[model samples]
Target: MMLVLLLLIYTSQHALAVVVEMNAGEMSVLLPCQFSGFIPDDPTVMWTRNDLVPKSVHVQHKEGDDFQGQNQRYRGRTKMRPDALDTSDFSLTLRKPEMTDSGNYTCSISGGRGERTLEDVELQIKDQQVEVKVVEGSDSVILPCKTKHDLPEDTRVEWTRSNPELMLVHIYPHKSDQRKKQDGLYRDRTAVNKDLLRTGDLSLTLKHPTERDSGGYICTIYRDKDILRQKVVLQVKGWFPPWATALLVLLVLFVVSGGLLFHFRHYFMSVYKVEVDSGVESVLLPCKTVAHLPEDVKVEWMDSDDKKVHVYQSSSDHSDEKHQVYRNRTEMKRNLLRTGDLSLTLKHPTNEDNSTYTCTVYNREGNILLKKDVLLAVRVPQVEVDSGVESVQLPLKTTLHLPEDAKIEWKDSDDDHLHVYEKRFDQLEQQDQVYKDRTKMNEDLLRTGDLSLTLKHPTDGDNRTYTCTVYSKEGNILLRKKLELKVKGRVQVQDQTGDIRNRSSSIDPTPLMADQSV
Candidate 1:
C-alpha cells in the first residue's frame, strides 16, 4: 500500500501538466504550474527545457528571480508573477512565442533536503496554413498573412518559395526599391505593403499569376532572435480562364456548324449562371423540369467538392445527411416533385458559396432521371458618389411585391442600422445615431418594388459596404443586397450619376432558364 501511494503521487505530477498548442505569431502563451500544501523553506523554483542549451528558462528563489544564469535565447522573452512564490503559482509567461520555442519544459522545486519534480509542459507552436486559388491571366493575387498585434519596428519580413526549389520572393525594408537580390522569376512580379510591419499585414502580392507561380510560399517575420512564419499554398488554374475557354469553344462550334452550336447552347442552358451580392440573405439554385418525376424519386444537390448540400425523398427533406456547413441552412419546397421544381435555397450566401452545384434526381429503381448544374457567383458591387453631393441613392429595383408586414432595413458592414422601415412606415427609433436624419426611402417602396435608400451629406467616413435586407413578419429573410459606397472627394456630380447609371445597366434581366423538351 505504501509503494502504490508513492506511484500514484508520481503519476499525478506527470498528469498535472498538459500539452499547449499555439500559432507562431501569437502575442503570448502561459505554461501553468501550481503546487499546494505546506511550503518548503528557502525553496528554489526552476523552469527548464532539456533540449535547449543552458536549459534554464526562468528561475525564482526566496531572494527573487535569478536571471544571471538564464539562457540568452530566453533572456527578455519570459516573465513570472511578482508574488508567484508566495501564491505557490510558478507559471511562466512566454512572450512572442515562435516555432523555435516548441519544446518540453520541466518545473521543479529544490529545498534544503533535495529536489522534487512538480510538472512537465509540452509546447508546440505551429505555422498558420492558408490556401489560395486563382485562375491564370489574373491581374494580381494576394497571399494573405495578417496579425492583430503590430510587430516591432526593427522587424524584417521575408517572403520565399520553398517547394519545387528554394527562391526569394520578396523582402521588406531593403535598401533598393527594385529588390535586385530577388529571384529572376519574381523580380518584377512580387511586392509587399510599404508599411507591413506597422499595419501587421505581411501579405505578398503576385502579379499576373501563371502555372509557374503555383507553389508553397512562406512569410517569415524576424524580430531580434524570434521568428514567426506563415505558409500559403497557391494554385493557378488553366492557361485560359473557364469563362474565356467556354466562349472560345462556343465561337468555334458556331463557325463549324449551326446544329453543333445549338447542341452546345443546349448543354450550356443545362448549366445555369447565378450572380448575387456577397451578403445576400439567400440564393436559389433552380432545377425545374416539366417531365413528371416518379413518386419515390430522390433529389440530391452536391457542390464542387462532392459534399451533399441538400437531399429530399418520399415527400420529406432528409436534412440529417447534409454536410455540416449546410446544416440548418438549407431548405427546399415540400411539393417539389408535384410542381417539378427542385430549387435549393442556401441561407447567408458568402463568397465561399461561389461554386458549381450539381442537382441529380434518381428514381426508386436507382436509375438517373434528370441532372442540372448551377454556378453561383457572389460579387460586391461598387457605387461611387461625390463627397459633397446633396444625397446619394443606393439603388435596388426588384419586381417582386414585398409583404405588407415585412421589415426593410439598411445596415452598413459594421452592423450599424442606417435606416429601418417597418409596419408600413419608417421606424426612426431604430435608426443609428450617426444616420438618424440623413437617410430616406421611397414612400411606397414595397408597393413600387423599389427599395432604394438615399443618404444625405455623403462623407469619406461613410465609405463602407451597405446591406439592405427585407424580412418577413415571421422573421424569415425575404431578400438581401450588398452595395459598396465609395465617397470620392472633389468629384463632379455628373460622374457620380454616370457611375450609378453604369452599375444599374450592368444588371442582367434574362430568365435563369426555360422549360425544354426532355
Candidate 2:
C-alpha cells in the first residue's frame, strides 16, 4: 500500500493542471508563469502550445523579443510586457483572443543551466454573445441563454443584471430556480422551462417588458467550481407615434409648407429611434456615413437648441461645447474616420434621456453631407402591454441577408415549435397544434432578412415569448430574435361621427352590429 501511495504522489507532482478558464472574444487574458525555484533575473521566457510542437507562442529576452518562426495562429496575438522580468513575471498575454485559441499553453524560463518548466495552463474560451432585439411595447420577450453541454445536476446557473440596478435577474439553484428571492420587479415576469433546461437551454421568458426592460444581463454557469459566463445586452426600443411628427417635419422642411427643400435637400436625411435601458447601461445612437468623407471631416450631434451633444472638430473632440447635462457621459466609437461610423454612445441612460437629437456630418470645407434625427426612447419593465390591434402581429424582423437554404424556427414559451420555415418551404406538419392554421410568414421576406410573423385571432393565451431562430444549412445559428404578442381586451373604438368611447372587456362597441367584425 505504501508503494502505491508513493507512486500516486509521484504522478501528482508532474500531473498537468488547468489553471485558468476564460470567455472567448475577451480583450485579453494573462497566462501566469512562476518558476518553482531559483528565481533568475533577466531570464529568457518562452510560451508554447503543446498541440503545436516546434512552434513557440512568444519568445522574449532581457533586451527585446523575436518571433521568427512563431505559429501563424498566434502571430499578432501573443506578447509580453516590457517590465515583466523586473517583477519575476514571465506570463504571456494574448490580445483579442478567439474561441479557436483554446489549448494547453506551456510556459518555460531559460537560465544558465537550461529551460525550466513554469506552468501548463489550459485555456477555454466560451461562445460569443448572440443578439436578440425586441421592440419595447411587445407583450413578452425571450432572452436566449444556453450551453451545448449537458452539465451535472449540481451546476449553478446565475442570471444577474449589474448595470442600471444591481438586481438578481434569475437564479437557477441546483436543479431548479428559486423565485421567492427574486426582485419585486421580476417576481412572476420571468420563467425558465424545466424541460428546456434539461436539454441544455437556460433561456428566460419575460412577460410585459416595457421601456425599462432594456439592460445588460449576465448569465453565469458554475460547474465543478469552474465558472463560465455569457453576456447579453437587450435593447428594448419603443414605438412612439410616428405620424404625429411626420407631418410636422414635412411641413417645416418642404417647399409646399412655407419651408425650403430645394437647396438643402433634406430628403437625404435619415431617421432612427434608438433604444436604451433605463438606468441600465449606456445607449448607442447609430450614425454612419453613406459615403466616405475626408480624413478631417467634422461630426456634430446637437439638440434643437443648438446645444452640442458631441462635437468633433479640428481633429479632436471639442468638449468646450458640451452641455452641462451631458458632461463626461458620452464617447464616440474609435477610428470613426476609418470606418465612417459616426455613432454616439450615451452612458447609463435614464428616463430623463428621452428626447430628440440631431447628428450631422460635415466635410472639411464645412459642407453639410448628411443629417439624421435620432429619438432616444427608454424602456422599462411594466405590468401591462399596449393591446391596440385585433389580430396581433408578433413582429420578428431580421436585418441580415440570409441564404436560400436557411433554416428558421419559431418557438413559444412552452418550448414547442410554433412555426418552421426550412428547406425552402414552411413545414406545416411540425408546427404546434396551437399555431396550426393561425400562423403565416412571407418566404420572400426571409431572403431579404425580414422574419416577421403574422398571427391571426391572437388571444390572451398568446401573451408569451415567441423566439425566432434563423440557422444555416450546416446547423449554425445565423440570427435569432424574440417578441411578445398581447391581445386587446378593453377595446377603444372610434365611429364615423369621430366619437371615441372605451369599451370594457371584449364586448363589442354599440356602433358595431353582431354581423359586423372588428
CA lDDT, every model vs. true structure: 0.80, 0.70
Cα error, residue 41 of model 1, in Å, equals: 95
Q: How far is each candidate from the true structure, as Cα RMSD in Å? A: 25.8, 29.4
TM-score of each: 0.37, 0.33
Best by lDDT: 1
Candidate 2's residue-wise lDDT over 93-161, tens digit each? 889878878877878888667888777776777676766677655767888877776678787777777
> How many clashes would you count in candidate 1?
0
- What would the TM-score be for candidate 2 when compared with the true structure? 0.33
- For model 2, the local distance difference test gives 0.70
Candidate achieving the largest TM-score: 1
Which stretches in model 2 have alpha-carbon errors above 4 Å?
A: 1-16, 19-26, 34-37, 126-128, 132-134, 137-229, 240-518
RMSD of 2: 29.4
